[model samples]
Target chain A: MVNWIGLYTLTSREVGRFFSVYRQTVIPGLISSVLYILIFGFTLEQRISEIQGVSYTMFIMPGLIMMNTLTNASSNTSSSMLQMKLLQQLPDLLTAPLSGIEIALAYIIGGAVRGMVNGILVLLVGVLLIDLPVHDIGGTLLFLFLVSWAFSSMGLVMGQIAESWDQLAMIQNFFLTPLSFLGGVFYSIKMLPNWAQSLSYFNPIYYMINGIRYTILEKSDSSVMTSLWMAVLLTILFTSLAILLMKSGKRIKQ
Target chain B: MPELAIQIKDLKKSYQDVFALKGVNVDIPKGEFFGLLGPNGAGKTTTINILTGLVFKDSGNCLVFGKDTVSNYRFTRSKIGIAAQELSVDWFFSIENLLFFQAGYYGINRIDAKQKIDSLLKRLGLNKKKNSKLRQLSGGMKRRFQIAKALVHDPDILILDEPTAGVDVELRHELWNYLRELHNNGKTILLTTHYIEEAELLCDNVSIIDEGKILKKGSPKSLTEDLGKSGITVQLTQESIDKKLPMLDLDYSIEDSRIHFSVKNPELVIPKIIQELTSKNIAIHSIKTETSSLEDVFLSLTGKSINE
Candidate 1:
């Protein structure tokens, strides 16, 4: 019970820490998503009309939301942990009565909240600019929450292993950005060739994006069951790895 | 029962191939201000890190408040607070916010935290800078704020790793007074310092360590008094004192215009030396007597200067 209270306070501090800089954390993503909608959804509408019976604008909205969710989630956890490390404030947390599990959950939850906020903001912008229709709002929300949770845990792992600002930037540049861009953000899998479609199936972001697309557009190239199962697997795998890293006091502690 | 606040036996730690602490043994009793004195790279930081659970030892046992550090880490850590040697705080956070956040980490409620924060801020002279961003404060103010942050949780034991480094004399004195007050309130403190005078004044007991080992451990007075060897100096107008003051039963040497002697009792030997010099009709320009100090004891025990 006491551990839960510690976790709650820690999570609140982590969340509040980022929100205090909301202009940098939340507003830019909203503006970026609006820009994507204007340039790619409207400007390129003439080039590609519809994908799987849904308008191109509506089809790309879920991908954009997932992109924002995963990026924000991962960035929130990784950057918070890295900042604590750089400032040497992590010792305060480490010396507290909280356990490693509590610490891990606090960071992951903070990431999830930021990711969800960014995703919702992107969704609201999509609705305003492109009139995106919601097919299954419940499923869409569920998928967004799960993806946020998964990526936030991944971010915590990255933050632990990263030793410097350059190393942190390298993870985002070399891994996260590429995975996000290639997760079928602007195009459907049917539009790609056989080999490309096969390759897209291997990217975990593909499942996240397509699963969310299934809920928001009612039209998905990937199977919903497969996507859901893949997301759950990724969440479990990433969360377990993050917890293990924290428990072992990997690069973060000593 | 008088509790043992900290105990370590055969503590060892290494980073990669470089050994930081090797076979260290120490015990600090409750309600005492203990000093760990060593030069840079002498493993003082490593010992504190291990006690704080920021670093794992390669081999050893460390107990805090009667609980094993490794097995009962959470309980052990909850009783201790540390102010690291480095000045590390979030530049974005105001002093008040940083204190509140640190209090929150220890599961202190906001209502209680605010009360504690206000008192700590005032005590540390940080009340004026409570709302100031950490980066905006001067170096000395930031250092004081760190001490305030460490005290917010109100742990039973406080460990300060070179807390007064880079602080000016006035602020250092202010900090010493604050720490002394904390000690008077029955808090056990473990301090690591480079300033020998600071240790002599603040610590109730001290240990001198070098090359990852303890060279001496005792009260500052006892440590200095135990090195009772004294030195005497005499000056003459002539450079021929080397021949005048021949090798006697006492240890003596001549350098330039001065003659130097080392004896167990300066009072018993100084009169005899003066008589010999007078009988020889040597003009004594000046005479001085000196006894061993803590600095000399440190050098003799560590085989190296403290500032080295």
Candidate 2:
């Protein structure tokens, strides 16, 4: 009744699409994460020495992992959807007897898979780079998955809104990229002024970064409980929006 | 009288203040090679899109195999395979991979899908290019691949929206032959094309649509017959041809050293005209018969050529 086979095909297609261009999709994120570890984790950590009783390398490791994970997840869905729309391939899936919810779930789940893979890869890279500890592996994985699902769903919404490659690039370059970097990836929010610290609470990526940081190093500038709730809320929020847009055929129907 | 494969009743859809389908009604019986002929902006593509769930209709009902398009959207879609005018397959995957994935979407298993895809590739002459990426394919190859994608699921109805838009003459003929074979094997087909000749040759029943409404509907032969008569022209070396040929009870006109006769049946009328001209001491060079074609019927109904 659910057309499970169709759902599997779409998910496989979406996932295989990213995998087809591993040089662009998977390798870039891995290389960036490794570089961040080498330059900042190795060099900058020497200056900062320690933040909240952990080395700065360990402090930034979770943030780097979360950053690359979410970025890859978001890029996986947004860039793929935008390409399909421009190339006129979206109609193939649309006509494939797949329900709107099934289509959205396949794409979102595909993004989440990419996100989780890159996150785990970065985590492994950090373990090798600085011998980063795993204080709570289960919690880290669950949070990584939730963040991936949320960002991927957000990417779907972005893809629906964008009409061309230029518009897609603007969303990624101006919004997603800047938000991830400024979401306290490099430094803890505790170092910011009180006003800036208050503002950091609004950046959803902040909760993700701190949440993973709490899992790996058992250190945080935000409450783990609050971060968990924020991740769930964002996941629900973005997934619902994606489904609604897809079902209504918003901005996509001819 | 027959089972309806596709039934549209007052289907309406308007986009950007332009009505793409204004109360369109058509019933495609099972196993009929139906043609929906229309010029550009004639809503043929829109009709296919709505049936496939790419576009939502503004009003009215579209049913495929007794399943309402909205209420049973997935079931309706699973029954129809559409080869759209625009190339819509993903460039990311190879031809074989794309077909395999497409088959899987229709719930086909890997082994069955692989066999079906292989058979399609061989039948479509795409075996050599199976491994090639879509971007690496020629325009003709891309068209062939589009057809293959649509057939991967083996749907009950195949909707071809201008399947041979820019294909070469030889390939177009081959494609028509393949489509005819499919129709003979009990596959329902709905074709839309600008090439009236394609429709003339391949369609069992056709509906000419213009401005989002049906202007004419009948078999190509029947439609041509409804025009009542064909034209016959004789080129004469000597032209004293200002005479109405009273022998055949028809009117004759002359232009460019040729005498034109409006005949009800050229086969029966040409010889009589030849006899009458010879008796009148007219030198006849060549005689030509221009039978009324679907083009003529289209012109009479729509007041414009198919290409226009």
TM-score of each: 0.91, 0.93
Residues A1-254 of candidate 1: C-alpha lDDT, one tens digit per residue: 45665788889888887898999899999988888777887888888877888777778889989999999999999989989999888888887878888999999999999999999889988877778888888998889889999999999999999888899899899988888788888888778889988998889998888898888887777899889998898899999988889988878765
lDDT of 1 by residue, B255-291 (tens): 8898788865566788888888877767788888886
Flag clash pairs in model 1.
none
* Local accuracy of candidate 2 as per-residue lDDT tens digits, B111-215: 888888999999999999999988888888888888899999899999999999999998899999999999999999999987889999999999999889988
Off by over 4 Å in 1: B228-291
Which pairs clash in the backbone of model 2? none
Query: For all the predictions, what are the DockQ values?
Result: 0.58, 0.69
